[model samples]
Target: MEESTINSSILGTKEYWENLYQQEINNYLDHSDPGEIWFGKGLTMKMVKWIKSKSSQLLPDDGDQIKILDLGCGNGHLLYSLYQQGYTDLTGLDYADKSIKLVNQMASDLGIVNNLKTYVADVLTLYKSNLIPERIKFNLIIDKGTFDAICLNPDLDLNQVKSDYLATLEAILFKGRSFFMIASCNWTKDELINMFTKSSQSFLSLYDEIETPQFSFGGSKGNNVTCLIFQRLS
Candidate 1:
């Protein structure tokens, strides 16, 4: 990990995303779609459709409804999209203060003043956060680029980061009902499947796959992103 400290994304850190939202927040107010939607709105809408079709399975009717946590939530665009689709039990967590501020502003501006909660909390240290209630467990946890950033960090500690990340997730998921939805431009489906199924430190089971768009990028024959769903087994 020390050797990876010199990489580009590591060079920017949370500061880059903060500056990005600061400059683009006003622009987002006018535009229907904005920057680095991580693959784009097309894929996001595809995810929306997938959720719409699978809501009963994902949310169930146990009377608890559905609770979702957006890890490294950035500006909360994913939560906003979910909100537009009429799913309201949402919470977003980010390490950057500015990102949380922007997410709250985005929610308030959209008149989603009460349904969404955004918190500033480090994913790597999430278990220690007092912002979230101890008894609450999420029905779904989502990640767009959080893992990519974690793996790219200059200070990355494989053992500590992986342990903390998985521990926090395990602590938050509702037994028998919670799962994780991860979308990434940094990993392939096989790679992700193996990471959870084969990794000695991981306890996730492959629940399903979210079909991703197939498109060429950098002359490749596949999409730049991969979407995967994993359920907690422990």
Candidate 2:
């Protein structure tokens, strides 16, 4: 499907996300056992490696910790992986209550509760409320499946919503140095690149686009996922 067409339905509102959670909550719960979360340890390691490869050049001279915000951080798998790799300043936001609960429980169970924070909030609505600190910036922001969900929403006003989202991202992202990494399956390379190019024209600059290997379990063979990295330039 065309990117614009996908965004027209999914990226337009919170109701879309809520309904998605309602439909998928059981599947998420069923799959989130101790060793059966969406991405296993191997994939999580690969994700961290991809994140680090994109973010290493942006690290501070003093080696001060970098702040990472993971959008739609289901079960905190990626965040947990980052913590294991020594990146502690991490925060995750998602709209699903079940996901939040599961992630928190997972963190507590694994004893990394002190290093992570998970919030139940829509990324589109995060800035409107106090879910995140005002004027806060992140060195890195990661999105895996969030945008795909947005595009799956059946009521999004594609152009306007995407424009607003891009602007909001610009406002919240660290100026001139932050990196945004998004992994998506529904969008092809050209479509993803075009969307980022258009979105970055106003707030960021294209830094890199890399193809990442994806793993699918069960009877499904995972398709290739694209990881698009953008750097704030304004």
Candidate 3:
């Protein structure tokens, strides 16, 4: 059976995010505006709270000890929140240079530049590239909407893209000791499970999940967003 696909959108394109972040940079410089939060501040905080609640289970020894990577970190809102919670080793990576610039600008303004590091790199091709050194591995990887954006790109082959993404995760995550948390509105809980776990080389397994508010219509209930956590199983 052919799997259903989400309609391709401009949101998937690098050019779109680059342009958006460029404008955000201008906005920040002129008006002191921070920029757009991908899912919203409330949801971002909710995610941080969830992590806080599970800190004992998630962190290696201390909150400052574990390295956290914000994949597709646009404007660094999520990392900023995590920083407030006392997670010191925070890195934000994005494909757009403007996105990195905006993150750096915000970090500088907040005087948290030393706590956060922003880099420009494509997540999809990251595993194949030497941009992020092999010696570096993250304890926690958070993806707010990066996978959704990757899936929405019209030009790419979905299967290959997903393979590359999972491969990248396998490469960067601290083997047998790391966790990956992702929040998505584009995929259902089951669909996401199938997508990540079905691959033959997949080393990730479902760990825990957080439920969002559900809406009812026509005697059916469904959530507008899905948040899930996965652990790397070696």
Candidate 4:
């Protein structure tokens, strides 16, 4: 494993995100915009569309609850977009209070407050502590930039996180045929796949992969982002 230069000592702590989300909420209020474009809206659209493409297996019915969960759902933009697509059972979880508050405000401003749910709870703790019961009942889970930040933690046990993630998904995905879509800028396509294949179980397996739109970097095409899709099989 190669070391990266991220403030794990800080980022791995709850205070880090609380402070960050506070600033983000301030920006949203002052500038009429949300902060941080993880992989950009284009990548988010690509993910949602790809899931929609697998409608027969991943979706319920049009305008019906699909029981969606958005992990580390900053500002609730992703949740808002899913609501626009008619996914009713949409929930957003974050460790920061401001993140949850902003998402709730966003939902209200968009007139979908009743359709979307937002909670302020540490997601990493979900593996052991069931702070939110709804955490284990999602049919579709979307993560953008959450794992990237998590993997940066220096004390991280790579395989343990994998096991915990799998456990949480298996517990919640009442809809057996569920999809977990993740977009990340820190990991390569191969690295993400290896994270699962190297620690395989029958519970969740890789379903597909999508390369985020690339850009010219160092005189060659480079994709700083990638989307990996996994399906709950047990």
- Compose the digit string of candidate 2's lDDT tens values, residues 1-234: 344565345443566545545445555457655433343455556678877775567675457778888888876778888998888888888887866766777788789888887788766656566767775677888887677776666665556556655655765677767888777767766676677666534666677865567577897655566667778775
Candidate 3 has a TM-score of 0.95
Provide TM-scores for the models.
0.86, 0.78, 0.95, 0.84
How would you encode candidate 1's per-residue C-alpha lDDT over 1-234 as one tens digit per residue? 121222446523777777877766766766843456755778778877777787887774577668888898877878889998888889999888877877887787789979998788888777777778898789889988787777666656654666687778877888786688888777677777766666676768998887776887688777578888898776
Between candidates 2 and 4, name the one with more favorable lDDT.
Answer: 4
- Model 3 shows how many backbone clashes? 0
Q: Candidate 3 lDDT, tens digit per residue, 1-234?
A: 357589899999999999999999999999988788887777898899988898777676544477899999998889989999998889999999999999998898899988887779988889989988888889889999999999999999998888899989998998877899999999989888888777787898999997677889999988888999998887
For candidate 4, report its TM-score: 0.84
lDDT score at residue 219, model 4, on the 0-100 scale: 92
Residue 187 of model 4 has an lDDT of 70
**Better candidate number, 2 or 4, judged by TM-score:** 4
Model 3 weakest lDDT span, ten residues long: 56-65
Displacement of residue 179 (Cα, Å) in model 4 is: 0.9
Worst 10 residues of 1 by lDDT: 1-10
3 or 4, greater by TM-score = 3
Best by lDDT: 3
Error of 4 at 1 (Å): 10
What clash count does candidate 4 reach? 1
Ranking by TM-score: 3, 1, 4, 2
Error of 3 at 36 (Å): 1.6
Whichever of 1 and 4 has more TM-score, that candidate is: 1
Model 4 pairs in collision: 136-172
Per-residue alpha-carbon lDDT of candidate 4 for residues 1-88, written as tens digits (9 for 90 to 100): 5522334556665677778888888887888787776678788788778767876776554444578889888888777777777777
Q: What C-alpha RMSD separates each model from the true structure?
A: 3.5, 5.3, 1.5, 3.3
